[model samples]
Target: MEPESGVNGTAIAEFILLGLVESPGLQPVVFVVFFVAYLVTVGGNLSILAAILVEPKLHTPMYFFLGNLSVLDVGCISVTIPSMLGRLVSHKRTVPYGACLTQLFFFHQLAGVDCFLLTAMAYDRFLAICRPLTYSACMNHTVQRMLVAVSWVCAFTNALTHTVAISTLNFCGPNVINHFYCDLPQLFQLSCSNIQLNELLLFGLGVLMAGAPVILIVTSYTHVAIAVLRIRSAEGRKKAFSTCGSHLTVVGIFYGTDVFSYMRLGSVEASDKDKGIGILNTVISPMLNPLIYSLRNPDVQCALRRVLTRKQAMV
Candidate 1:
């Protein structure tokens, strides 16, 4: 295929994704592993989403956010895994420039949405534990829906801005992306033009989209922790911690990996170790979210059991 020229007359057609492993013998194993992870991620999140939707008892603010989160997990994993699996199986690791940008767009969009959704979930927990009397009034159905909508809008806008900026860059040669997927920083490294503006925007938007939500989550949890500590009854403290424990765990895993990946933007180049970390945030985290909630949150477990029992009875 003839390489397509961008507006800058740069003859760039596609990018070669040097996938997770270069060994031909390990391709099947890697494909199987990631494919299984993808399946588990989809199945786990779908079950959570189903349990929440079917169980009327779970139709509260917390589960509402959980449903949104499950959806995001499914999306976030789906955005990258299928293409990755295809590359692994076919050994055709080349992705068209347009398709690469599309992946970048959806990946960032869903990831950003996850960050905000987790923050919203934290706020819901804060209200429930720290201000129980006002929790219902504060996090009504309308308010919950509005919070989710705002998250999507903010995430989409951020993703769109980066995609537009990335599209404008000129790629003269060496269209190989080192990571398993097409990421913004990796793309920045490949761009032949000045990337100071892109870097500034990335840092600025990173703070707004990622850092802000992380701060809010931390603040919410701090308040929750203080409130739990002040409770006179041990059972009350336990219950309060249980309420937010899953969210905190998830936040730690996600933010820990993501901050490591993005925060050191100017210091070093993208390494294979960075790709491994990326896999944690992109693949492993989504698979773990449902497991953490289902195992830690009694409500989700009971709801899932109810869903399964009903299915068996119907059968």
Candidate 2:
């Protein structure tokens, strides 16, 4: 294909995704692993949903935000995995141009919102633990709703900027993407048109969306840790530390992978090891999040028990 001007161009309608590697021997193993992860991810998030909905005590702002987070995580994982599974089985990793763009749009939208939501949750934890005197007043229902709305809006706006920027570029030849899923950087590499603006915009938005939230989360946790330290009783300090520990671990892992993924903008070399790490961030992190939060949280555990017992009695 050759590059042409405006409208009809030399660009191909479909993109060949060179997923993971070209090893036929590894396809089945990879397929099984991802398929199981997808099932567990969906089931775990749904369990969180069921627990939250069935237990009255879990209806607070924190649980409400958590339920939202689970739902988003499910979506984030779903967009990438099913297509990957299909490709694995069929030995065809080709994605249509339109589908690639759609994947990019939704993937980033959900992922970006997840970033903001985690920050909001960190702040929620801060209000609940650090400033318990006015937790209700500070994190009221109205505020919670507003926070969720803003999360979605910010994510959509962030994704739209990148999608629009990415879509404007022309891709004339070598329409093969080097990653399993459609990442903006990899996709941009395939573009025949200049991607300097797209690259800059991507870096700017990455900082604004992901980097900014990391900063906010870090700041919130600093306050939370200080509050934990100020508790007079050793037991109280231990309990406070335990309560926020899960969130802090998640934040560290998420931001650590994310920063490593995007911090260095220019001339990124995607070695086999680098791609494996990227997959962990993109695929495994979403699965691990609900597990980490729900399992570690005593409230969620009790709420889940209540939900199960209630269901059992009904049965």
Candidate 3:
């Protein structure tokens, strides 16, 4: 279908997102399940955020980073899931051009933030484990605040470039995005206007945003693991390993899936398998961070137990 002309003569005022799956038979079922997941995702992250804020014991730099990560997770998931829930439950999956732009802006912003925050967390762990003597001096309150501020700024700047680049493209034909959301590559493919610039920008930013920090994380943890090995006592080794293991797990899963999905440079046909894995990084992975980081850490478990016990007593 040809798009009607808009006020400024842009051909696309709205777009039809083909979404994850088109089976009308499955939409309602998908809706029920994903809506529940969305609720749990939001509620669980919020509880973690609240506990971190209220608990004086968790007022350290690690939980501070975790709290920032929880906020990022909530924002990132919210960008896609609410609309996903709506599309799954409703008869229509139409997304207006403005709304798609909004989604693109936020989806990238929050995701970029998550990537950077994870790196920050790795650095925090490195300081704590590898340089315990100077950990306090290195990761003090001023430094922690600086790291978080830099992460947000970098994320916003990265996302804004893509959003503005996307806005400049002319979507003159085939106004249907064949994905659940407004993705950069898919949208670029559908544009009738010259997208060489957008493609270049996407390629450049994709590498810079996802690649650099992954290298940092790998380096940080390589040293951390080596440091863990140097501990003379088995008990000391166990303690260090426990502290770094959960974070390393989350970072590996999140970055591994992300780099696999987005690091492509050409006109690659991203399969359903690709999209599925991307969804894992965006949706499933963020949900797992809080669980994996907190559940596996004895400190966090103790804090949660105390918080819960106090609540139960009050009740």
Candidate 4:
């Protein structure tokens, strides 16, 4: 079937997403592997979210932000994995132009939200460790809610700006997206119109949306490290380090893959290696977040154990 022309005569209605692997033999293997990862990512993050809500002991600023993070992780993965899985099984791996735009919007929005939430979580840790006396007062329930709300608003605005800019461009002939997803850079490369404004917005807003939060997280952790060093008792220092360590690990993985992908935007062509990095950023990171937090933190483990025990007793 031929693709319908858009209002702009040259625009194609749909695009073919040339996914990660081209070989038919590898499709099933890729599907199974990613399906398991998706399930684990959803289940683990939901469990963490449920535990935080049910356990009275977890009704603190730190757990509140952790709950938000889990939610964002779940959303970020959901935006891409389902579509990618569908494309893997179907012979005709085509996505509607509108659907592609929508996917791009949500993917970036959720990613932006994840960045801000991590920064907020780091700030919470900083206050707890660096200014213990003021921690509770500074990160009260009201303030915590406000911070999460601000993160969502900022992220949504950033995604909207990019989507709107992309909508204005004309796609004349080539309708094939090189990667598994409808990423901004790939879309820019396909446009018939000059994308100078789009490129400028992508770089400027990308930095504000991603770079700012990263800077905040690093600065917060620096202060947290200094505060930990001042503690004379080895046990006290160990406890403090453990508290912040899980978050640091997650931040490192999320930022590392993103920097690799987006920082090198000068290259218009997408490679197989780029798709692998996207998988790590979108699929692997979300799955690892719950595992890292639960395994590293005894408090969360104990809370999860209690929840499971109570469920078993009722059964």
Whole-model lDDT values for every prediction:
0.88, 0.82, 0.81, 0.87
lDDT string for model 1 (110-214, tens) is 989888989999999989888899988999989998999998899999999999888888889678888899988888888887888998999999999888898
Give the winner by lDDT: 3 or 4.
Answer: 4
List ranges where model 1 is wrong by over 4 Å.
1-9
Clashing pairs in 4: none
Q: Which candidate is the best by TM-score?
A: 1
Instruction: Give the CA lDDT, 0 to 100, for residue 23 in model 1.
Output: 93
For residues 185-295, could you state the per-residue lDDT of candidate 2 as single tens digits? 677667777778887888888889987888888899899989888889998888777767877777777778777666555644445554776677767887887778787
**Per-residue alpha-carbon lDDT of candidate 3 for residues 141-258, written as tens digits (9 for 90 to 100):** 9999999899889989998899888877777778877677787877777777777788778878887898898899989999998988988999989877877888888888877887
Candidate 2: which stretches are off by over 4 Å?
1-10, 309-315
Q: What TM-score would each prediction reach against the true structure?
A: 0.95, 0.92, 0.92, 0.95
Better of 1 and 4 by TM-score: 1
Looking at model 1, the pairs that clash are: none
**Whose lDDT is higher: candidate 1's or candidate 3's?**
1
TM-score of 4: 0.95
Question: In angstroms, what RMSD does candidate 2 have relative to the true structure?
Answer: 2.6
Ranking the candidates on lDDT from highest down gives 1, 4, 2, 3
Ranking by TM-score: 1, 4, 2, 3
